[model samples]
Target: MVRWHVWIKEHEFLGKKGTSQDGFRDLLRASPTPKAVTGRNLSSEDLSKSSLQGRYEISRYAPVCLWEEDFSEVKQAFDDLRNRGIRDFRRHFEKHPEEILSFAGKVKINDVNEYTLELYQAKTKEDLLKGLEIVFSKQSYEVFKEELIALADGKTRFMSEAVNRTLNGEQIHILLSLAVPPGYKESLSRVIVCITDISAKQRKARELERIGEKYRKIFQNAIDAMFVADTETGIIMEANESAGKLLGMSTIQMVGMHFTEFHPKEEREAYRSIFEKHASRGRSLSDNLLVCQRNGRKIPVLFSSSIISLDGRNYIVGMFRRVLSPDHAQRHARAGKSLVTERKVSSHAKERLSGREREVLTLIAGGMSNRQMAEILCISEKTVETHRTRVMNKLNLHKTADLVRYAIASGFVS
Candidate 1:
């Protein structure tokens, strides 16, 4: 290509077509002026025009905003700063922010393509360049400081996200990439910068954040304890305040713990099986399950869970409510067992005891000691004993084993 351009120049075929030793030269003659040229008499103005023309050609139809700037003035100031033993441009600029503003003023905008004008809502490149103070927001100074630091560290290229304002005073987000031409790193004369508008992406991010905050409030304030775990890893991703309070720990302390850690250590396999089933089926409900608190007390809870998908990954959101009474646990347990068996307990026998008495009976059927029952039900041991005596007396059961058998027969526990 360079050879063809040289041939076109050598042949003085500026605006005429003619055949040459290289047949393609005849084809190139009819085309517009090529960007590259080589000759002893090439003036700087001619080179500048050629460079700007080439930039326009390359970036005229580009989607990103392109900027050709000269940082030679900023480079000289940096050199002066270095001579004064200032090595860290970032720290120095942080303390003396006015220097960055001064350097920004000295930096020159060489050229900007059509897209740059459109992005900044400028009708002409001159308007965009002259009104740079309006185009650059305060946030842009932070990015400018970082770029200066990169130049000080001998970096040839830098990229970052920043905020800039339009001519209309509307803020826009931009992904800025700045690079110096291969040999111009020290001189900082030919710096090419591109800005990709990311205002839409940032707006979407903020919308998602607002939606997340809304759901977060719902989760934290929910009456039922809630937990979210990764479907694949079974590691707890999040836990709400209710979950932490129910288990006697801070919500943050529950995150990163294995899903099975909240359940009884002795019942790990059973709870793991339940977790795996929920993950596979995308939903689950169960009773007769035990949750272990921080104090090592196991309490019965009605657990329900459903799977949710986000960003192509699946998660399980489980909600737990502590069983208020044995009747409640028995009702859930019966609902769960109905799928496997059609056996139903007599309504008369079920209605014989109150909810509290039925709960005592269910705990007794589960072989829980009176002290364990007190801890789980948040009641005194004497209160638990009283409920137990009432349960036996109301049923006319003479022995503890008889009461257990009665509870099983009534479809309260398996």
Candidate 2:
């Protein structure tokens, strides 16, 4: 044997300070061979064993319960069944479930992590294995058998939610994932199964679905019209039944259309500006707007709007209520003047005025200038001015404002 000099570094001291070379030599002599300064014995077998032990330690502390199962026996049984002229494996398995159950029994639980013991409330690995029969009932076994067959037919992985029972007979929902390691054929493979308890997650999902259904009913039956639109483009995303009825359009027709389409062409731009301003500042309310129906009727409406964040995007949710104008109320009132009577009264009051004069008067009462009235009535500005003069003279009004007051009082501009 050759003599070797080892200079033990201060950091290499395992227990106490000032552990000299002489003390290390004594320790080396006490052992059969000198251990490496790295604290591991130098041997090929020891290195391999340490690597496996490290992997085992990682698996033991893993968040999910890990299982290694041998499916070779099941694969052999499947081959035997196929040899017996069973071409439709699924139908055969369903009819002769005993064969599938027998093969399931052949699946050996080669190993399991410590988490498996904790999850199943088992005192030992042996106890957990013994309880596997009770944990997997006949119904669940059929479902598992189908996945197992798929896995054996070159499918490298499988995932599904499964119902399992613990040792205490408490059922748990588990998200199960099974995969075969690379370079291993399914027939001769060891499957690695990862199980995560998803009972709470399933419960939460069901609760959210229930809440969503409840809100959907409320939205459909609401009396006020509701619209959800894209904040950036003003495109309608969703409209309730009330909104469709109020706007005189079907719900299907309202979706994907621009929200501004329901307003008068002249007011669309102004409405858009106000909507943007309110959205930027959070929320806004307006009671002076009118929504146009498909029949060309402009109905005054009260609107309240707010910005809503959904799925990381901004949306505008608006609620609208029809506002009953004085004219609208008069039209619908039961004891009010009949249509013929109202028309007669309207004609009698305006008998002294020409059609052009009446038109100019209405436009003037609506705050239109001569230029606007001329453009709208398809005439010249000088002609509009002449009509205004005649209207003021015929009405015996001294000022232009007086003409407006007279037109309003007579319901000419309503």
Candidate 3:
């Protein structure tokens, strides 16, 4: 017999004695290979459990108030009203608000987060539930009812900016989101409602609206011509009524036109340089600038420009005043070194006279009658007479000869 060593280690057998092949086979048969261990099934179960736990925690500790409401009673009440031939549920609810208010008792508040208590200034959840009736004023209840009906009918998933009151009687604005959980019909659905405080946001929006309205009124009624243009492209974005009148164009026609459109072709490059320089430095004043009107009339204007920022974009705002009289035009022209020699009046006496008054004085010095002056000026005789009187009073001249002498002395006439 041959000796063989057999060693047993844990559950496996190693032979030390001489063994037959059958005995070795029997040992191999008795010890089958251990099955492969896998945690896939266990992992799937843990994942589902953790997912539900996460949802629960989120609902319980959310920043805003979250609640699950049972609307079974409200549905039943509406069904009863429908059986009584009330086709329009809204109309019925409006007429019988007391009945609708009674239906609130049937609705159950299933859960509420900590935010609910804090928002309502309640010490406990029960305190909040008890004071829920005070939260819905008459107007708020009306709004709430409409939202509830829409939610039950699956018409909308969310409603926002609903006004509510707190336990302390402070008004609060809320945005509400509604959802129906799985396996629930509309009538008996468990609705999850999320409430967010939007009181501050609503107040800010209304304030901005009021400010915009005030600015609109001021812009529309301003006396001076106003133009708003894109700073980079020089394209006109907005023009006031006065601007259109000054340019002899409609407001609609003025918009979308380039700023250079109002300048003479020869002076457009100069004006562009001035605009760019002023825009870079914040403001600029160009006196005696000639603006070409839509009717081909050249209007002497004083252009005041400033850079304004709106909605994070830079814009150029220009205010312009028309030169009404020749005297005024000459004065502005002299400032720009473009004075007209023929229209120049050197008399100190004519300095006190306005453009219209100077025109009347020059004609008076030429021996023109009031009616002739009116005809030449395309004005009424009465208006011409008024201008003559003002000129005489300003010069303290009693007679036409004295006015004519003064006009000649002032170089207003040949």
Backbone clashes under 3 angstroms, per model = 1, 0, 6
Model 1 lDDT per residue over 327-394, tens place: 75466545545321232334465577775676677678767789765644546999999998887666
TM-score of model 1 relative to the true fold? Answer: 0.61
**Candidate 2, run of 10 with poorest lDDT:** 1-10
Model 1 residue 407 CA deviation in Å: 23
Better of 1 and 2 by TM-score: 2
Q: How do all the candidates rank in terms of TM-score, highest first?
A: 2, 1, 3
Please identify model 3 stretches exceeding 4 Å from their true place: 1-57, 81-106, 210-218, 232-234, 248-253, 264-288, 293-296, 309-313, 323-414
Candidate 2 on 205-314: residue-level lDDT in tens?
A: 98999987876775576566778888888899989998998989899999999988999988999988887777677653433478999987898765655576878888
Reference-based TM-score of each model: 0.61, 0.63, 0.56
- TM for candidate 2 is 0.63
What is the alpha-carbon lDDT of model 2 when measured against the actual structure?
0.65
Evaluate residue 364 in candidate 2 and report its C-alpha lDDT on the 0 to 100 scale: 79
Model 1: worst 10 consecutive residues (lDDT sum): 1-10
Q: Using lDDT, give the best candidate's number.
A: 1
* lDDT measured at residue 5 in model 1 versus the true structure, 0 to 100: 5
